[model samples]
Target: MPGFYYPIYFFQLDAIKHGVSVTFSFYSLVILNASNFVGRVTSGYIAVFVGVINLTIVATISCSVLNFGMIGLNSLVSVVVLGVFYGYLSGVYAALVAPLITTLTPDLSELGARMGITAFFVGGIGVLIGAPISGALLTSKYIWWIPAVFSGTISLTGGMVYIIMRSMFIRHQFKSQA
Candidate 1:
């Protein structure tokens, strides 16, 4: 979320920097958000088949890849495409996050407390600091790609963590069965 959030918060400025009309810049966000809505709605069914962890890992990694694609785009069409793609992938992560948490919890009794802690860390601290860091990277020159790379690296790191957690979960499962 830090990855997606920072880029989204600065998207308008980036678009305007590229000479895209202000109105269209705003519309780019709308397009992204609307696509996000669609992705959230569809993700449930997709997760049913793909499994929450697998789908989340795929979406997070895909988002990282797409953020790298944001580096050199100079057209509104390209921006719009990036918004739609990134939005959908990020939305998938959003939708599945709670379920992912559920899987991580060993006891249902601890779920609510764990969820709150997770939200505080991810949404509160991580997101709060990430945008400013990205903004700081922008400087007066508005070097958009630098921030894009930063965001991509964050997402990639998150994807790697998820991969590690998944492996640990599998190992635990196998041990319990044995």
Candidate 2:
């Protein structure tokens, strides 16, 4: 999520730098937000059928994969398309976080405490470092793709971590049942 935030924070500037039309540059954000709105609403319905953790994993992977497309393209059409997909998947990811956390915890009584601690640590650290690292990449100008690649890789890594966590959770559940 932090990885994706880089673009949400800096995309307008990036668009201007890349010579994209001003109108399209603005539309890029609009398209992303609109799609995100749709995704958030739809995810609630999907979560009921698919389960929150499952949906979150799918959404995370989708965002991770699409991040590569966003990083590699500069055309307005590509940006618009990728932006919308990324926005939607990201929205799903955001919507599912709390539910996913709830699913992982052992005690419903501890849910609030667990969520608060997780939010404080994870959100705090991500907010502190994500943008500055991305900005540093941009300022270095070692390569244009560095920031995008960095963001994409981070998102991909996050998805992989979630996969591992899910597997461990399942294993624990089975062991407890036995």
Candidate 3:
């Protein structure tokens, strides 16, 4: 989630760096938010058929690709396009993470505690660490690609983690059956 949101947090800065005015940058966010709403609502239903983990992995990876695409973006139109796509993918991730957590927990009684712990790491620690690191990468020079790469790499790493978790779950199920 932190990885998913890093681009959103710094979007204005990215826009300014790429020669977009502050006023237009705001519209990009509005567009993003609108599309995000659609993605969140639709992904919930899609997850029922496609599976939460599978969709999440796809969304996360797609978001990483979009972030990487940010490296060379220089126009408002392109940025707006990127925002629309990123917003949707990030929204998918946001909607599915809770269900993914539920699947990981064997004891339903521990769900709340597990969610709290996960939230602490994702919401608390990740936010704390991610922003600063991305900011530092940008620094006074405002080299956009540096932070774009950072965010993309983080998102990609997150997707890989889900893939590993899914594989582990499948392995566990097979072992138990055997």
Candidate 4:
């Protein structure tokens, strides 16, 4: 998410910077965003059938894998690959947002709104910064590969966080049963 967002965002920004026409820029942004719509929605819905908490690990790993794939992309074909991968992953990611809140919080009533807030904050603040910052990384003598590094880092970080949290939850559950 954060990783893909950064590179795509930079791609968008770069296109605009070069006066690539609004249609071109908009289409690029649209393609980039389509990944989330597909990934987040589909995965999120599936999270509903399985335990949301359980799927958290799945979503996290998907994020990491997709992000790494995203990092390796060097052309339009890669973008399409990213869109497919990210879209599916994003679906899971979005689904887990609410489920995660429901599992952790006592009040299930506020789950939707609370999770929405969390998503907004995470997407807006965390991911929003990814592109521009990576773009900054690109400023230094055409170091295009820098974006891949940053995106890869973001994916790995998100995956680690999911793994740690899922493990803790599992341990807690096992202990309670014992």
Clashes of each: 0, 0, 0, 13
Best by TM-score: 1
TM-score of every model? 0.95, 0.91, 0.93, 0.70
Please list all clashing residue pairs in model 3, or write none if there are none.
none
Question: Worst ten-residue run, lDDT, model 3?
Answer: 1-10
Q: Arrange candidates by TM-score, descending.
A: 1, 3, 2, 4
Question: Positional deviation of 137 in candidate 2, in angstroms?
Answer: 0.5
Q: What stretches of model 1 exceed 4 Å from their correct place? A: none
lDDT of each residue in 1-178, candidate 1, tens digit only:
6776865788778778888899899898998898889889999999999999999999999988987887866788888898898889888988988999998898999999989989656567878888889989888888888889999999899999999999999899899899
* lDDT winner: 1
Write one digit per residue (lDDT tens) for candidate 3, span 70-125.
88778988888988998888888888878888988888999998888896665678
Give the Cα-based TM-score of candidate 4 against the true structure.
0.70
- In Å, residue 129's CA in model 4 sits off its true spot by 3.6
lDDT of 2 by residue, 33-71 (tens): 888888888998999999887788899778767756656
Q: Candidates 1 and 2: which is better by TM-score?
A: 1
lDDT, candidates in the order shown: 0.86, 0.79, 0.84, 0.65
Q: State, as a TM-score between 0 and 1, how close model 1 is to the true structure.
A: 0.95
lDDT of 4 by residue, 1-87 (tens): 567465445655555444456565566667767776766656655766877876776766666676556445555555556655666
- lDDT: worst 10-residue window of model 2: 140-149
